[model samples]
Target: MDNNYLIIRIDEQQNIELHYFWPSSMKIKYNYPTCITIHFDNLSSCFSLVSLCYCFNILSTSHKLYIGVEVFKAYLSVKFSQSYIQE
Candidate 1:
């Protein structure tokens, strides 16, 4: 509810999942979609602008583009599976 954090998890298959966390309440909620899957010949395509922004804190989730940023101020945490790098 106040000061949330954005966490992105990318699996070996390039499956991305997003969730919001509130340390105060110790809760985590998934975004609209539980998971986002991208299929392409090259795995590099998974690091597109949109996904990069989501991973790098360049984009806001809760505000839904209303303020063009996080209203309560948020932090970003990105997790990648070991296979992600080996790919």
Candidate 2:
């Protein structure tokens, strides 16, 4: 997937769901229940660091962390609701 975003789903117990895109060369294991690691499509050190920090900031914001996710989900729900792709 060429998605440049992360998807997080949270439940009643605060258990979180996360899905992210990873590059091919990296290996990762989901050892932590609350976190998931993504192997980026590129190994650009500067890019990766900046992106990680940026996402962390976005996810830590008071409302962006939750509201943004809900909004993205709703958008996807509506977008993929009816899909009859013509070949």
Highest lDDT model number: 2
Leading candidate by TM-score: 1
lDDT per residue (tens digit) for residues 1-87 in model 1: 235554454545544444444345434463342233433232345345335544335434454453223211111112222322110
For each candidate in turn, the TM-score is 0.29, 0.24
Name the weakest run of 10 consecutive residues (lDDT summed) in model 1: 71-80
Q: Mind giving the per-residue lDDT tens digits that candidate 2 earns over 4-58? A: 3445543343233344434344354632222343232222342344346543444
Instruction: Compute the lDDT of residue 40 as modeled in candidate 2.
Output: 23
Error of 1 at 25 (Å): 4.3
Compared with the true structure, all predictions reach lDDT values of 0.37, 0.38
- Lowest summed lDDT across 10 adjacent residues in model 2 is found at 37-46
- Give the runs in model 2 whose Cα sits over 4 Å from its true position: 1-60, 82-87
Question: After aligning candidate 2 to the native by TM-score, how far in Å is the CA of 48 from where it should be?
Answer: 24
lDDT of 2: 0.38
